[model samples]
Structures are given as structure tokens and as C-alpha cells.
Target: MKKSQLAVQLYTLRDYLKTAGAVDRAFARIREIGYEAVQISGVAAPLAAVKKAADDNGLVICATHAATPDLLGNRAKVADELAMLGCKHTAFSCVSDFQIIDRGAVLEFAGEMEKAAQELNQHGLTFSYHNHNMEFGKIDGEYILDLIYANAPHMLAEIDTYWVQYGGCDPAEWIEKYAGRQILFHLKDFRPLFFTATTAPVGTGNLKWQEIIPAAEKAGAQWFIVEQDSCAKNPFDSLKDSYDYLTKNFVR
Candidate 1:
């Protein structure tokens, strides 16, 4: 797929959307910036209102990242909302805080995800998990993410490239290893700082975009959503720079 065929992860714009009327305005700005699609993190407004904003801006809501509590407690409601908004994929944004401390908690989480995936699958929505740096930590000499993938082979992964680097692994390697299991990618770049990785606009960071993009495409990534967790300036400027860079260098 062309690089212009990109989706913006609305989480990157969270700061701008903190107030009541900001989400609608943010969606409009996203469209004006030339994004064709969006992956919603959370919209405090009603589902209908969110859908209207997307429609007004000519942006497709292709995917969403919901908290595990929302998914488990209100699977039907969540699925219905996503379906109404024209989203085909729903992902658990992060593991519970407790799960982060208790490594064993992931097995139960995986079980829950398996059940949730089964439930959402019936509604024509594929379920997935979005990873952070914790999943890359070594447990018993293997990455915890590997264990999750092993336990829930059918579950999709929204691989965050920056987190992969932060976890001290290669995003392209994971892309090649998982292949078809990764349905989407969070395409953020990382800049090395001291002992850690920091978010940078795509192409400006150390990530091998040339290698990673092609690998993700080969692995069947349907959406490459741009995300910068903490922007150096306004979120829109960061997004515009990243979008321009990717389009100029990667998009065909």
C-alpha cells in the first residue's frame, strides 16, 4: 500500500482533545493535514457524535484502542460503538497496571483476550493487543510478548515500533517473525538518548524505516498509524512533519 494511505493514531493528539469540544476540532485538523484514516484511542463524546466528526472530515475510523476494562466489561457496547463508527478492528490499548507488575497476570489476560477476540470476531471486528516496552522485557530468557503470542496465536498485534526499540529488539525482526499475525503497526520513530529511546518524527529517528516498512507490508500490516507519544512542539506540527517525511521518502 502507498505511504499516503496512512492512518493517524488519535492518541498522539490527546493533549489537544482534553476539553469538551476539542475532539471534533482535532479530527477536523487531522483531515486537513491530509490523513485519510484514523485509529481512535478514546473520544469522550457519544458514538454518534464521534462518527459524525469522522464523516464530516472525510476520515475513515479504521481501528480503535480500548482499555481492557472497557472491552471485558462492555464488549457488546464497545463492539457496537466501533461498528457504528465504521471501525473493523478493536485493540486493547494496554494491560492493566497490576498486570504490569505481575508477570503471571498476562496468561489470564491472554485468556480474556481470546474470549474477547472470539466475541468481537462474531461482530466482524478483529481484536488485537497494543504492546508497550514492558512486553519486551525478558522473562525466563524469552520476551513476554512471545509468550503472549504463543498463548493466543490467533490474536492480532498492533506492534508499536518505538516500544520494540525501547525493549531492545528490532522492529523488523519482530515483523518478520510474526509475519501475518501483525494486522497493524504503530509507526513511530525512536531517537537514542543516553540509555533509552525517545520519540522522534518518522525518518528523523534511528529506526530503519526503509527496512521496517517493507517488512511490515510483507507481514500483512493493513494500517500504518503514526503516533508520537510526547511531541516536542504542538502535536499537529509533529504529525505534519512526520507525514511529510514519510510521504516524500516512503510513499510511492
Candidate 2:
């Protein structure tokens, strides 16, 4: 993967991006940290302001966590917003009302995703699903994640490495399993924090980056985004640490 492919998931620094000016400041810091791209999520600023900040920082809007309401309720609006931001890819993290209780539920959500994806495609945008640990559960003897992808052919996979490990699966194996169907990959390390597991800066935890990076690259992942949902110190510090590690090692 090239250094240009490495990005910061803005959700990691959600607390610092509450307004237009904050986004500008945070993005400047992000660019200074050596990230050339970012996945937009959890920011409160308007799309126009976001675009301006990104442009000023020389940061590429690689992907976004599309608002579920707009994605399911109004695809045209989501597409237009992404177009304004100059982003071609968006991923649905989750919906508040959507629940994956069984096989039927999974299929139902997949159908919705399929419809939304088709609509987005018409507007020159690609849609993907971002997974959490809950998706690792089984439904009708199949992993919910596998079932979702098996059914929603139009929806790509945006696998989160830390969550995959949190769900008790091998991150590299899953990336390899979904080869050629992924354009965005989340790179966060998982480790035991006292009594429970938590996310860490890339290469700072126990995750096998050497294997994960190669698998992700081979799987057609174009963006390797670092996201630490929770951090021990300033989120920007965590972002810099991850950027330093990836650029020095993986980004070639």
C-alpha cells in the first residue's frame, strides 16, 4: 500500500470536531501528522465546511460513514453530499432501528443495503457495510457478516480489524476471504486493557500488521484507515503514532 492510501478515520477524534472551525483545526493537525486522507464520520460540521477544511489541509476525502437516515431514507441526498465533498465511497456503519436477530433479519437488512447501493451507484457512488463485533455471531450456521456479503452483492466490505479480532476471528483470514470485494479497510490494533479489550494505535498492540497489511492489500483495499474508538490520551497523539508506524513500515 502506498502512503497516500493511509487515512485517519475522523471518528477517532470525534470529540475535537464539534464545529466548522474545530474541524478545520483538527484536520490541520491530521495533515501535520502525515495523513493524506481521511474517512469522514462523527463530525458535526456541514458538508461544505468539511470540504473546505479537507481542501485547506490537502486531505483527500477517501470515504465516509454515510448517515443511515439519508442513506436509507434519501439516497439522492447522500449521493449529492458525497459528490460535494468529492468522495466516491461511503459505508453504512449501522442503523438505529435495524437489528440482526436471525437469518431473516440479516437478509432483510441486506436487501435494504442492496437497494441503497443500487441507488448510490446510479449517482456514481459506491456503498459498503462497516462491521462490528456483533456481526461475528452465527445465524443459521453461518456468520452474519458472511451472510450479509453473500446476499448484498452490490455492497462492499469495510472490515474493521480491531472489531474482527474483538469478535473472535482472525482479521487477516477474513480480509482474504472477501478478496476483491473491499475498497476500504480499517486498521486498528486490539489488546487487553486491564479486564477488557480496547483499541490501540496501529502496530502498538498485539495485532499482526505484517500479515494483516498484505492480506488487505491483496483483497483490493484501496484505503487503509486508522481508527481508535477510545484512546488513553489525546486522540491526535494516537493518530500521529499510527501514522508514524504505518508510513515507516507498511506504506511503500
Candidate 3:
């Protein structure tokens, strides 16, 4: 991917974006950190202010993690907000109270996502689904993530690397599997914690980025988004570290 296609998922800086003034400053810092684009999520500021912040910093609103409820029940409203931000893509973050063991629940959610994708298509916007480790569970022996992609053909894949690995699957293989249907890739790294793993800046953790980046490129990805759900240091520093690694090696 080109450096221009690299972006920061703003959810990583959620705490810093709680106000319009904060959004403006945070976005400026993001631009200074060398990110050309951002995925809007978890920002408490008004949409107008968010747009202004991006514009003021010369950052593109590449995509967003739109709320699941809004994607399922009010696609038009989501579309309007995306249009206002001049972003053409948005992803359903996750489901609520989802029971992975229930096959019916999985299929039901897939159908709903499909309907939402259709509605989003009408608005000339792409709809995608963001996954977490829970999606790897088996329902009647089929992976829930596989089922979601099969049942909801219209929804594009927004694969999160750390979550895929956490789910006990190979991240590169999954990214290649989606091929043409996937366009957004969340690059999150994880380091071993007490009993599990915790978020770390890309390339600093144990993830195999050398393999993942090539796989994502071959999958026709349009955005390579850097994200760390939680950081051990200042979030902006974490963002910069990830950006430095990506631009130096992966981005062209």
C-alpha cells in the first residue's frame, strides 16, 4: 500500500477526542505524526467539528467504525453522517449480546448485516463488518466468522489482525481469503501479558507484519489502519511509533 493509504483509527485516541477543541488538537497531532488519513470512531465531538478538524489538518476521513445499532436500524442516518464527513466507507464495529454458540443467532445477525449492506449500497457507500476474537468460535462446527462472510455476501471484510491471531487463526491467510471482497485492514499488535495479550504499537509486538502487509496488499485493501485499543504510553506516541514502522517498511 502507498503511504497515502495508511491511516490511524481514531478509536485509538478516543480519550483525547472527548471535545471539539480536543479533536482539533488531537487531529493536528495526528497529522504531525505523519498520518494522511483517519478512521473516525469513539470521538465524542460533533460531526461538523470532526470534519473541520480533519480538514484543518489536511487529513482524509478514509473510513469509520459506525455503531452497530445505527448500521442495523438507521442506515440512512449513518450514510448522511458519512457523506457529511466525505467518507465513502463505514464498518459495523460489532454486535451486542451476541451468543456465539447459537447458530440461529449467528445467521440472524448475518442476515441483518446483509440487509444493512444493501441499504448502504443504495446510498453509494460501502458497508463492512469489523471482527473480534469471539467471531472465531464454532457454531455447529463452522467458524462464526466464516459463516458471517458466507451468509452476508454484500458486506465487505474489515479484518483486524490482532483479533484474528487472538482467535487462533493465521491473520495473513484470512486476509488473503477475502481477496477482492476486503478493503480495510486494521493493523493492531499484541504482546504477551500476564495470562493473555495486550495492545502494542505495530511491529513492536509479536505480530508478523512482513507477512501480513503483503497479504493485505494482495487482497485489494484500500486502507491499512493502525490501531492500538489501549496503549502503555501516550496514545499519540504509540500512533507515531506504528506510523514510523509502517511508512518506513510497508508503505511505498
Better of 1 and 3 by lDDT: 3
Model 2 Cα lDDT, one tens digit per residue, 157-221: 99999999998999999999999999999999987878689999998999999999999998999
Taking all chains together, the TM-score of candidate 3 against the true structure is: 0.98
TM-score-wise, the better of 1 and 2 is: 2
- The Cα error of candidate 3 at residue 208, in Å, is 1.0
Candidate 1 per-residue lDDT, tens place, 1-252, comes to 685469999888876665546778988888888888888875556567777888887888888887667788889988877868878898988765567444577677777788888888888889888988889876678788887777776689889999999888999998898888877789899988896667988988999988999999899998889999988888898899889988887787
Q: Which ten residues in a row have the lowest lDDT in candidate 2?
A: 94-103
Residues 1-252 of candidate 3: C-alpha lDDT, one tens digit per residue: 898998999999999999999999999999998889999999999989999999999999999888777876888899999999999999988755554458888888899999999999999999899999999888788889999889999999999999998989999999988989887889999788887998899999998999999999999999999999999999999999999998889877
Where does candidate 1 stray beyond 4 Å?
100-103
Off by over 4 Å in 3: 97-99
Q: Which pairs clash inside model 3?
A: none
